[model samples]
Target: MPGPLLRPLPILFLTRPEAASARFAEQCGDSGLRFDTVISPLFRIEATGPLPDASAAGGLIFTSANGVAVWLAQGGRRDLPVYTVGDATARAAEAAGMRAHSAGGAADDLIDWLIAHTPDLPLMHLHGRHTRGDVAERLTKAGLTCGSAVIYDQPAQPLSAEARAALLGTTPVIVPVFSPRTGELLAQERAQAPLLVAAMSEAVVNALGPLHKRDLKVAARPESEAMREVVSDLLKRALAGDY
Candidate 1:
């Protein structure tokens, strides 16, 4: 079967590694949306260590694939209730043979869910060094201790020569910016033009800062599905000479 290129405007993704590119291809293909990717990884994932005690907490939480990987590597529990911030993370948890529970699409939403679901239960949140959310604080307020176990750190990398060329030389690509850091890097490179930013939510939009937001087209949902939907919508709008 052929891929999705039904829309006049081709989608582009701004990410450093081939992972983002590959994902854009699959999602677009499934949705009948044509997309090309740019390598601008923005950050690299680095693993450190597991928790000192490593006892099972009241629940488990994941915000990224790296977090899931690290938790699994550390012999983390596979039976605890897993609260994930993104669909990608949820999928990762499931792939690791764990039961996954989604709490909306972002950390804040997950925190809200935790607040409502188990207000008094202790929880351990697995995340990156630079991850967002104040679930711990909120949980503390509710007389619950939320321990954050940082398994890895993310360091922002730069764009490759090919990526720079694609952003400058070609017409434009639909870059899916999932986090504030990725958005920040892109915002630093171009003041305007030659790229489209598909932000996941209002938080992501603001994370990119005002300058980036001025040029970005946002997604309806903060999930992977919503991000794909925005890619299709933006392509249609771009083809129609409206955006």
Candidate 2:
């Protein structure tokens, strides 16, 4: 007798900004995962205002690549040292010719690192308006002089038609929620399919509240790499009909 046939893997729904989703999809490809992906950004990254003058700051801080892009677009200089919350943001800063340092993790990791290193006084953090961690405040409380500015905004956007269709279909859908805001946005969506979620942190899962899902998994660490691993595990379980 022939062996049982394998079922198709669930579709992966990526709901970050356009550039960010593309980057994650690219990383998934690099990891040799051939699962289908639908990139439907739920937020649009827009510059809030002109970047604050940084001539007097000892160094620059970036918690997201959006901040780096906005700062670069506004003719911001790259001479000052840059400290970032994660490797990806640090890479973005370095690509712009800035001296970049990565805390290799979340905002809390960056704050702790800054508290230990105690870089030049009055570091300037350029970030979006809807950020969670009070990085600048925490650093300052830790005795490191750090100031911050809101340079970008991540306003919500409706899901694309294709995304809606995917969510409405019977096929399984795997969603990797990177931020609590994204999770909240997803909670408002109506999904008929068997939904599996890979949340980046406890906050992301908490944001889902009472949303119905077939399964949920939180990353071991609040980082992109950890999320990727969580996503992979979800995919494997989904294909095996473990959900």
Candidate 3:
């Protein structure tokens, strides 16, 4: 007596940079959710090297892990006090032997932390090409005497063939978007399958705009672990056909 077979879980589409998306896929594996993953980076992170001399700067700011990696690659000094947007970036900075503090949220949170704690004057924000929030500008307005440097560039990249196929197929697809820029790029594409999205923040969700998503979930926090939890929840919902 042969019984009916169950359908496979939805594809987990990751669209961060190559390394970042791969790391997230690994995290999903570690969390016991082995859904098939497609790593199609929406942005290629290239280091804009020859970092500016920060001999006069007293503090450092990193809004993304990519910035931290580029900084380490460029032999940027780590002696300055470092503030980061999320725990992941702080952890990356710490791994590089820097004294780093996490705002535990987004750029606004980092700015608030700087305003409250008032770190050393003439702070420098090391970031990527496509960035928002104007961290250094806002900080300087708040009387923090902050400056910024473009350390890397995240130019737009086309989704992989596999990603495009998954999006156009009948099988379900689950996408966990980490940044607004990723969301913006994804919004430009069309999906035929049932698409579920797990966004890292309100900004990400907003950037997703008018995508015809079957289900959408926002992480409770801006950290990577929070996004993972949201994805896990979406997986359960997808399996149950709750979307």
Candidate 4:
């Protein structure tokens, strides 16, 4: 006789924006994986000001979709050189009329790209106030003149009482952290459960700090799609079990 399907695994999702949760749900699907999300948005996305003038920026950098969306909403020139840290941001930049040049899918990689296939123009990094890595500083330290604007702040949102209880209860939980802030939150809360933590790169995994490694299995890929792709495979396993 076949074994009883395990109850849907209880997974925790970290999200601040409503949109983020919706996508997470779609990603999880109706697999035997029950989702318990904490609306702990390590930051918020908001328009800081008018879209910058490309004539003044010379070139631009974007690492987050919020940066791309806000700039697109404000309408910048479609002809400027746009550099991005990840593929999604590049796609968003393209949607915003920016002819984007990718930086190898990571902040650090982008810096390397700058050093290699370099652009001969003054650069402006359009980003969130809470930048994850040392890209801008690395560029400037390398003697590159890069301007910047804190277009938004990715502030953390605290978990609610219900979410806390659900998380504290039993079940394997997977957290796919796209940013260090999300990983830091998981590290700080160290709930007693098997954690499958995924990030976008080795740096992002390191950025999670000691709290993450204390009691979790961690995996970091190189892109948002890659992170989601890993989680998708887990859901497929769940479906096969008929849980």
Per-model clash counts, in order, read: 7, 0, 0, 8
**Model 4: lDDT of residue 64:** 80
Q: TM-score for model 2? A: 0.92
- Best candidate (score: TM-score): 3
Note the Cα lDDT for every prediction shown: 0.69, 0.86, 0.88, 0.65
lDDT of 2 by residue, 84-188 (tens): 988878888888889999988788888888888887567998988888889989888888888889998989999999999989987788899988889888999
Model 3: per-residue lDDT, tens digit, 47-124? Answer: 886998899998899999989998998898989889899999999999989999999998999999899988757889
Summarize candidate 4's per-residue lDDT along 1-243 as a digit string, tens digits.
Answer: 999776765455555466765666666564445555554455567777776555766788888877877777777566777888877778887876678888756787888898776677888888877776666677778877787777766666666665555456555555667776566665666455445565656655776777532133334446666666666665444335422
C-alpha positional error of residue 172 in candidate 1 after TM-score superposition, expressed in Å: 2.1
Answer with 2 or 4, whichever has the higher lDDT. Answer: 2
The all-Cα superposition gives candidate 4 an RMSD in Å to the true structure of 3.9
After TM-score superposition, the amount by which residue 179's alpha carbon in candidate 1 deviates from its true location, in angstroms, is 0.9
Clashing pairs in 1: 12-174, 15-39, 15-40, 15-41, 16-40, 16-41, 42-157
TM-score of each: 0.84, 0.92, 0.96, 0.79
Candidate 1 per-residue lDDT, tens place, 56-164, comes to 4767778777788778887877877688887788888999888888876677778777777764556887778786776666667766677777788777787777676
lDDT for model 1, on a 0 to 1 scale? 0.69
lDDT order, best first, reads: 3, 2, 1, 4
Give candidate 3's root-mean-square deviation (CA, Å). Answer: 1.3
Off by over 4 Å in 4: 1-6, 28-42, 49-54, 74-78, 210-220, 233-243
